[model samples]
Target: MAERKSALKRAPARPELNEKLEKAKKQVITEEQLQEQRASFVYGNAPKGSRITKESAIKATKHIRVVTPAAA
Candidate 1:
């Protein structure tokens, strides 16, 4: 009996994209940035100089509202 081959062949991997993925995987985050993220999560606001009042937040975001999609 003859063996059947796959109809679809795998595309060759792109070194450029692979390089980008490698760089992303090896990314390093500064301690300051990490601390800022932690502070924001803990305080529910930006740290120190970046602080914005509730009014500012609402105004800046233009009063965002939760949107529920219509059922299909």
Candidate 2:
């Protein structure tokens, strides 16, 4: 007796895969352009506390600095 091939077995079509690959290739953009676009969104919208006064900056740095002990 000869073995028979299954009729349900099939291979994927090439055109669908090619179309997906072409779409993926066109979606890429550079990081520099992305950053430039993001910068435009916040061009004039500064946060309330974003303005750093000299006194406040000095105080913040003083509080955040770590002191080291002398080695014997």
Candidate 3:
């Protein structure tokens, strides 16, 4: 009987790997840029038992800034 084939897998192509690395590098975000992005979540109609807190609201929006409406 002939020798059995190896089950090892080949690594990703060099060019493709380099392109992926480059894309990842470009995806890096700076603190200043992060501070510039902001999202606002206001109290809105929801199920009667639903609730939202300041910290939770901020975290739900990810690292971006969270703004809230000024008291009327």
Candidate 4:
């Protein structure tokens, strides 16, 4: 015959863990933070003392000139 299983017990909580949880719960994100995260995800890492934002966007030239050899 098999024996019955007992209920699992919980470990005592630490004050440091509680503090960290409280800090995380109270943390808030700002618009700039969202922008930085988005930039990092799309463009990889940033440089020291400076970060790339959406303001510096790259655009392709719309005008192109094509010339054919002088009536060869």
Candidate 5:
């Protein structure tokens, strides 16, 4: 029986991509920017007293059969 060996090849390193990655690593987020982002997520532009309640959810889904995995 004869034996053979296989070799793997790799791509050359990119200095431009390394420089971009280093720039991205040095990027920082300020506290004000973080607070603004969190506020935008937590508080929407909806009018007051327009939130959905449990009664509203029940009423909306009264005629629908929302089947669960457990029921199936």
Candidate 6:
């Protein structure tokens, strides 16, 4: 009896997606534009001395730092 050899299968080739990729790339926002939009959302047209809300407090805690002087 002759031993049977296993045949190797080739993977299917990937389809071309350059058009889809270009569309996705165009949809992406630039970092500078994103920053400017976020700044506007956070600080635009806010009333003076408005009490900070919980949402703003969380944002402030995430982005702002407090420094305390060393005790003498």
Q: Which model scores highest in TM-score? A: 4
Candidate 6 lDDT over 18-60, as tens digits, reads 6677787889797666655665666654577887554674465
Against the reference, the lDDT scores of all candidates come to 0.66, 0.61, 0.59, 0.57, 0.61, 0.63
| TM-score: model 4 vs. ground truth | 0.34
Residue ranges of candidate 2 with Cα displaced over 4 Å: 1-25, 44-72
RMSD of every candidate to native, in Å, equals 14.6, 16.7, 12.8, 17.3, 16.1, 14.5
lDDT of 2 by residue, 1-72 (tens): 999998897776799899999998999777555554445444434356677554444444434445698998
For residues 1-72, could you state the per-residue lDDT of candidate 5 as single tens digits? 777655565657999999999998998988566555544543454355877554444444444455667764
Per-residue lDDT of model 3, residues 1-72, tens digit only: 999877797865799889999998889787555533422333232345677654454465465455898999
Error of 6 at 33 (Å): 0.6
User: Please, what is the TM-score per model?
Assistant: 0.29, 0.25, 0.26, 0.34, 0.29, 0.29
Better of 2 and 4 by lDDT: 2
TM-score of 5: 0.29
Poorest 10 consecutive residues of model 4 by lDDT?
A: 56-65
* Backbone collisions counted per model: 0, 0, 0, 0, 0, 0
- CA deviation > 4 Å runs, candidate 6: 1-26, 50-72
Q: Write the per-residue lDDT of candidate 1 for residues 1-72, one digit (tens) a residue.
A: 999998799978899999999998999998566555554454465567766755555444543356999999
lDDT of 2 at 44: 36
- The Cα RMSD of model 2 versus the native structure comes to 16.7
Model 2 worst lDDT window (10 residues) = 56-65
| Candidate 5 C-alpha RMSD relative to the actual structure | 16.1
lDDT of 3: 0.59
Q: Give candidate 5's total backbone clashes.
A: 0
